[model samples]
Target: MDIQEKARPPAEVYDAQFVPALFAQWGQVVCAEASVREGDRILDVACGTGALTLAAADIAGPSGSVVGLDVNPEMLAVARRKPAQIEWLEGAAEALPFPDNSFDAVVSQFGFMFFEDKPKALAEMMRVLKPKGGLAVAVCDAVENSPGYGAFALLLDRLFGKEAGNAFRAPFSLGEAGQLTAICREAGLSHAEVVRRNGKVRFKSIDALVSTERACAWTLGGVLNDEQFERLLNESLSVLEPFTVDSGAVEFGMASLIIKARKV
Candidate 1:
């Protein structure tokens, strides 16, 4: 939990741990839904460590062009080291640097929840897409929908405080399909369609799960002191035991709301 000053950056932990456990599979899903094609221009907004962006590049191929953009330079730095002939840009979602109608498709995975101006960010995505370009976004479903996480959230509340607990639920903030659909419509992304899909999360052990969240800014955001994090970890052993498999790895069901739309 105490990512020491000399420790590997949190972004590295995310690419090494979080991506394989959660975001990696969804990368293909988002790209496919966004209709990424060879020789097409593609943009991945909030493309942390190039999960979805890498997927897009493969599909787009040597003939196609792909760009990954994110506000966090630390994350982008991690992305740049990956071996891919694609552009990696550092920028905000609310104000994309590309010109209008620039990309054939735009996609994001599990990043929309962090956008401060959701509507404006969605609009910016739409604005950059070529006419009739595809758009897709995937956000984790609510904490209530994920049993293990729900228990963890309650544990956080019981131990740390409501604020600490709420931080854990931030990724699930946009879980409601209706709310996301409304945001798309309001952003001038016409005919947005949302579908609920089941997903799964896995970690080597309960301790790995707890420690990963402790390091992830998207989740715990370093709110807990080292002692408090250790406390949470100890308590989670019992709270999350139901989801732990015989191999001692923690596995549980999750859901994501995949929003698909097109620019007209």
Candidate 2:
């Protein structure tokens, strides 16, 4: 399957497995960093299953308006089940459907890296924000900096191929702070600041981590046969043993870069 197809997982799996494990904390951080106010109009671009969108809606309150836009209909379908107060729209980040200067804040959590046209997406985000409005984005750092994901990618490469491994690496492709800042500037969002922070990646167990990856992670589900998946589970448990804590949960350090900017 193509990368796009691989990236699309069952909405149920995404909401149940991926969101709580990873995206939820980043959602809170991104919305807070973006300064989503009680009555501010907010836009969440590439909002996968509304992790950030829901957070923004809660922060924006009833007086404020929040819209969650994504190119994936399945993702939007999942998000639509959330608070009716938040408008969930289907659209691409490269060409947002909204009019210019329509939002007080635009925030994306772990979504900017997947846009096919980074510059155009940045431009659209800039175009939608009110003057001096904030934009915040969080993206994963290098795979090397995330030991769990690094090991996962290496195992995928060994088991599948480089193509399969690329799915894991793609999210971290734009991890560099300089690259992120340059993109914002190139898209006319000058004065962008990129901050790197360390975060913890935790899972109840090695099996839980592998199951979540197979269910929600890109290019993982449907690629491995039953036997292969079992082997992978065993291998992952072995690989993650060093990171297992006293409670038998796997916890590892992962770094992320949060890019903050404002329209001039």
Give the lDDT of residue 138 in candidate 2: 89
The model with the greatest TM-score is 1
Cα RMSD of predicted structure 1:
1.8
Please give the TM-score that candidate 2 achieves against the real structure: 0.90
Q: Which stretches of candidate 1 lie over 4 Å from their true place?
A: 1-6
**Which residue segments of model 2 deviate by more than 4 Å?**
1-9
lDDT of each: 0.88, 0.82
Q: Count the backbone clashes (under 3 Å) in each candidate.
A: 0, 0
Clashing pairs in 1: none
Instruction: Give the range of the ten consecutive residues with the poorest summed lDDT in model 1.
Output: 1-10
lDDT of 2 at 76: 88
User: Which pairs clash inside model 2?
Assistant: none
How high a TM-score does candidate 1 get?
Answer: 0.95
Per-candidate TM vs. native? Answer: 0.95, 0.90
Worst 10 residues of 2 by lDDT: 1-10
